[model samples]
Target: MVGKKSGKALRDEGLERTDNNMDLSSWPQVQAINQKNYYTDYLKRDDQYLAFRLQNEEARTKMTKTAKDRDRALAMAKPEGAEGEAEADGDATMEDAEDTPIETAGSKVIVIHVGSQNLRIGLSSDALPKTVPMVIARKASKNESEDHPEPKPKRVKRDDGTAEEPENLFGEEWSSQFNRMSADLKVHMRQNKRRMLPNSKEMVVNFNRRTVPETISEHNDPMRVEWTELSKPPPEYIVGQPALRLPDSSNPRYKLYWPILNGCCNETDYKSKRELFLDISLILEDAIKTQLGLTSKKNWPQYSCVFVIPDLYEKSYVNQVLEMLMREFAFARVCFIQESLAATFGAGFTSACVVDIGAQKTSICCVEEGMCVENSRVNLKMGGRDVTETFIQMMLHDHFPYTDINLWRRYDFLLAEELKKNLCTMDEASVSPQVFDFHLRVAGQDTQKHTFKAFDEVHLAPMGFFEPTIFDNSDKLLGRRKLIERSVDIYDGQSNDPVSTAQSEILTALAPPLPKANGDSQPASSEVQATPARPQQPSALGRLQDQDQTPRSSVAGSPVPETNGTPQAGGANTPAAAPTTQPSHPAVESRDDILPVFPLDNAILTSIAHAARSDEKKMKDFIGGYYGRWRGHLDQWFLDERLRSLRPAFTKDIMIGVPPRDLDPQVVVWKGASIFGKLNATNDSWIGQLEYDRLGHRLMAYKCMWAY
Candidate 1:
């Protein structure tokens, strides 16, 4: 009791007498203790309150859980149910569909709308993203130096049976090594024509024996790097534009570096996607800086972009693009889509059939009822650039290729795209030869005239505006491959194998009966080869087919990589090149069947197989048209009655209690649209274009609306 009293007295004295118990370094440090305590006192009070609230929350959570358990137990133990249920028993885990809980892990992942080019990066937000496209660029350059040389690949033969080394086609150490060899060859020719490499020692002695070092110095003479033009190598680009690094139009065909972007429209190897990406990224970054004035030195390309690329983008080209982005743009996420899909998505709600006629290529995506008709996607290799190429080849045929380009090149293809976009009509007979004679100035000179009838004869069989015939001649050159896949061959050899109803169902569902008629199901007993659950079993000769193997460790049907620089080849586990062996009897020629206009290339191919010989040409035309129809299909997806039902029934707002302080409760709780709709609505862009005023009459049961 006495000790306790003494301790209390000391505490009291310390609190009352401030400076007496405080630490003092010399003298000035005494204030540090006072300053620290003064600030900490208010914090200590707030911390105690926080601790009390946390304990209260814990107690509340436990009570709530206990109450829930009790209520559940009571319900299970109900007298009428429990006593009567003594007759009924079942497995504990098994449940009806209505009782099944939501499986969060298996929830469908929703795609978000963002920009067009980027890589992954950190954001301050807590939400983990559902999907991200790889936009990172890879680095590639010709490394011919001794210290950092490129690895050599084993030589391989070309399809036509010519063997070539990698260096023969790829770059080599020509600048330094070739120069030395040239000097040696000149010296040898001047002094010792008869002195072969095997006679080097004998020749040195026989040639009046200059010291080896002296000879070497003379060959490597500093004067060799002189002002004379004879020593320089001739430039490589003596003719037309170069080829693409990746097989697109962007990079010139001959440049050392070529990384093509989706929708590229220029020479490939000479320019690169990296160059274009930088221009885009800079525009975005500067726009952000101008608007927000963010001072923090953070990473760049903070958001992401979507890129649409062809299926055959080469590995090296993709890698180079990613490497450049990493080196230049700071950090971003890249999203990849089929260029057709992007155009369709962007234009889906606006047009019934989207025909994206760009500078380099034209694509068709047919949308029926506002959803992308998966079966009706089509991409034509011919674009406005093909028109320009046709014009150039026409000039070449006329012996004025170089002369004409100097007159009009830049605006040529651009004009072609504009023409297709603005002037093209579905009427074939209306397409006249005189339509091409529109005059444009060449290099600001007197107006020059040209006509489509004067089309370069070279492209007569090449530029297929709405048909696959453009590639027919080239494709014919690639004969049937020596090794057709065994699986396809065996599948074809079967006889009396009943044509399964499943295959017919898939094909016929594509063409539903007219509007008032109920859809008919293919009878289960029909005899057709069963859906083998494979796409192809062979490799494309020139079609850039993908190998039928799982990509990395991903399971079958996982989407192909969605990266800005990466190539996309449909779904995972795609077959390379399946044999197309026609069946013996009626399968070869079905007379009365009409092909479904489902707006997809694969669908067209399927339809083409059943078409009459006379109709084959017309079916091929649909392949090119499919790409343009996709937009029309996707535009209608928003009009789906299922989408409309999700919207809030009432337009009026209700008052909840006041939100927590500083909570920025402006969060919009959309009534009907899913998360995707909210995101699409972010800027009132595409979704808003669908006027809400006319939506009243189209309402239907939600499930039936979006259902397939």
Candidate 2:
């Protein structure tokens, strides 16, 4: 408390009585902060709230645009009875202008490479393609008649003000424009349809599949006099990046669907086959418009497209996809490319064993001189998602036991992916001391901080590829090295080493005849025995024939017996000596035997060494870290001297392994498609729109021939 003599004191100490607090309220920074607070208050919502508002706003905007579009379209579609003279005058004025085709090989090219997890799309001129989640959600609609299109007119006027010309009817431009407009109409109508829950009075099929009557009352029944249709929102197909949010339960009415999976048309989806194709086409259009920044609607018909599909895509599916694209999008030109070839070419590899690790599985294929070795291609059910799941389970059981499994599977799976990106390492060690810290968020819970160490568990995901036991029935899967071995063998036939060749011949020559049962008379031998036959056990040749063990390679310099003219030594595994008392089978004949020999070719070893020296992480990690656990199959393939010897003779350069992301395998397909488009332009190799139409679905067979 201050004393009451302040006035007198103030008079005595004049200016000192004034308040000394600095006035910072008028500063720009303070004002800016205040403005931010006001802005936040004005918006006042979380993501879901904003999304709700934005969706409604978008619906309004779409309706306005659609109404305006409809009006403009109707005006354009008006019969030319009255406007014939005006249009004739315009055509007369523009008659000097020459008509040109819209599609040209030199035009812009669009490449879309669809993977199980993402879609990589870009213009051929761009350095890199844009990636978006391969997902789509159909939107909700309020009114059924909003997009109910009228029966299309018999003929639509051209933008050039010309009446329908008979010759131009078959013209590329007219066909493309017609197809595009028709596709757009169909898409709008499809989006406008309301997806209703079975009527409230109808039955509800619960998870148990029990049909129970829905909780509905007579008051809400449509049959009631006062009942009316409730206001419903307009439906739209949520596609690409935006569709990712549908899984959060924000808009339960919108279900997500994948138009393409594992790099081909999706067989399992919530959408119809035609619907799926339309969705993918729509997504492609959106990607072109939004991501590539190609806004001019007229420029669409001028673009060519390349779709990179997986090697395993069925012929029928390929035909269907091609037909759909040609009928729906109707780009100037379109071509199909296999995913493996594209990746290999994109990586600038002349010869490589590309191990593509995708979301659904890991596909390995060998490419020699830009061609995929058909027989060597193999697929594994383990991939990035599998690794994430393993990590999630580890965290749930070993680290955070209280977290809900279902919630983690739904929401935290993304966190697991993030964790993998941050903490996962491909170090060539059985165990690593890598440690990382990250946050995990549950739907209704606070974010929890987690410190994850013991990267041994993290290695399990990649290791699972080498050791199949990490997952169920994975033991049937082949390891990376084995895949390479098999691919090399397929590329270069059986061993070419002279010694192996000779040994194989000798073994084939010495193969004993099939042994007869005791009840049957023994087969007579060509050579007669000097000693009288003793009624005793079966002869040594008969016993050996009976054993019939899988033939294996003999060690170098093993002894060969000449008694009874029997085949030299049975095999390296066979004993050096046999009892002299046993007589040789009389019917036995001298012949070379075939032996199972896994020769580790020197070229293969050299290839592996080259890969290791070049810092190929997958091969390096496989050799240093995974070899011990995966040696059984690896040894069978790599330990053979013949394979090692044949490796040098292998003319093509061999790449040991490819890491999933080393060269950005995700976008590699797009890059490959771009390369193919350029090559097609240079060599005039691409099939034209006219040719495609003439051949129809047979273009796929032609593509296959060209690809092989």
Candidate 3:
């Protein structure tokens, strides 16, 4: 009976046996806390409500039923063996696969590009990738999550002692409710930034924002309050965008972060590292459903996932995290591709150097014949954000007499980024400094005139990529042109010095002719007899090896017999007799012919590197394509004279390939990733789940070596 006793009864009996034991339930404050809220009853008397509570409940039931019906209709519309349709406006379907017959195998292809700032998702054959800010904001209230809260997994033990297939704990009712809530909240948040409230008489003029109130007074009108806030219990986490915390919230535990920073997951903080791992998996799952049209939870495991990351990040722990996610999500197959390499292939190039300039950093790599040259890749910690920050610092330095650090902190960096996109120009001459005047509102102060001279100074910020020191970086900081030069220098040697160590090494490796055959008797002429006869054997140095075997004619300008056995005579039609024995000089191939092959033959800069690509063109003095877009003061300080010197004879030019006119620069990587998925499907390049489980990270690491 004791063993069967309830836990509460056993605890109470133990407490009674102890003389000094105190019963917390007997405490007056504890009792009061447990009592019903009488104030809420008083408040409810004045609160607006339906004539009957039953009617209100019935209305909610009807709405719930309607949402279920809609979801069912949507599900019914999607038939088995039918390919998911790409969004008509946001994304374009790529050249239809020659054999797109829907896979009867039940597996689907989903390509996802997770960048430092945004996430792009689309089906394998989609021409364009749908982009979403890699953001997932969570509200603190459990109630808010009821509608679209993430599905909870339940573990079930099997007879074999291993965990069986996990079950989704939420029922259809919750799923439908969550879906409706997600739709409503999305609409609310999107419309929250509008200049005018929907169906409202008031216009939200400059600096005036419609605000939501916590509660309505009994005497005041409830509908008069414009609801701008989209979250309840405030948002506990905001991803992608800047972090915010409401000071008035009771529990303002907020977290905003990027799962990836500098192109990889943060390894320093274990908690954040794990959180990011889970977050990316969840985000990718959503992409599979929303973008690939695989809504059935069971079918999720049948989707192949491809993650695009920087080439330099292969050695990082990202591979490990990806493997973990692969198993956790039960994906049909998975693979990783380098962002720049994907872009190169997507641009339809067998080889081209790639320069990827993103929001947080820039990477330059040489690709040759479908392989990335590991030694030639360079990653720099400078990109679009730094330019915007430079603009912000410039404004703060000039405008606010007594700079409030908070003011600077509160300023919208996104707005500054947009301004940079619009007003920033590549040509220094176009920078016309204009006096800008605008009304500024501080958190606690009245609106005031915030006036400052906005000059072509904006153009100077982009020059940081060219001259890192302007942004307080060391001389080691490499600009776009310098990046290209670095790649070329690997083969051509430094321009300032004629003989590069690489060139010398190559020269040393070329074998000299075998010791001349000993001419018995008299010591072989004291004068070293030049071996006019080239080596019979070919060399590693290609045809550079000398193969001529003819004695020099002592006559000063005598024409030598042509190798074709044609006797040359000085005639008007005859070219000067080919000087076969003129000079046995070592072969010096032009830089173009000897350029080391890389994964990409040309340096193709995606949209983010528009500034760098533009600056590089100006440096090289190229005046075609997008070069006409440059309209700025010519700043010599930002120029790389070395690039100008090398331009005339430089064999290879950094190529910023012209993308399809409708494609956005930002989506280039995703488009490439999408195309890659299609190629993988056709080529059977992806590692299937069974093989992945068997080979594991070793296979992943091995593939990373040449996955591009």
* Winner by lDDT: 2
For candidate 3, lDDT tens digit of each residue in 521-633?
A: 22222121111111111121111122122222111111111223222212122222122211122332112111111111111121112212324443222211111001121
Backbone collision count in every prediction? 77, 42, 28
Whole-structure CA lDDT of model 3: 0.42
When summed lDDT is taken over every stretch of 10 residues in candidate 1, the lowest stretch is 664-673
Local lDDT at 523 for model 2: 32
TM-score of predicted model 2? 0.47
1 versus 3: better lDDT goes to? 3
Model 1 TM-score on a 0 to 1 scale: 0.29
Give the Cα error of residue 231 in candidate 3, in Å: 4.3
Give candidate 2 regions above 4 Å deviation. Answer: 1-107, 139-235, 262-265, 295-298, 407-410, 428-435, 442-446, 472-665, 681-685, 703-708
Deviation of model 3 at 113, angstroms: 1.4
For all candidates in order, the CA lDDT equals 0.28, 0.45, 0.42
TM-score of 3: 0.48
Higher-scoring candidate on TM-score, 2 or 3: 3
Task: For residues 499-532, write the lDDT of model 2, one tens digit per residue.
Answer: 2121222222233323447654223332322111
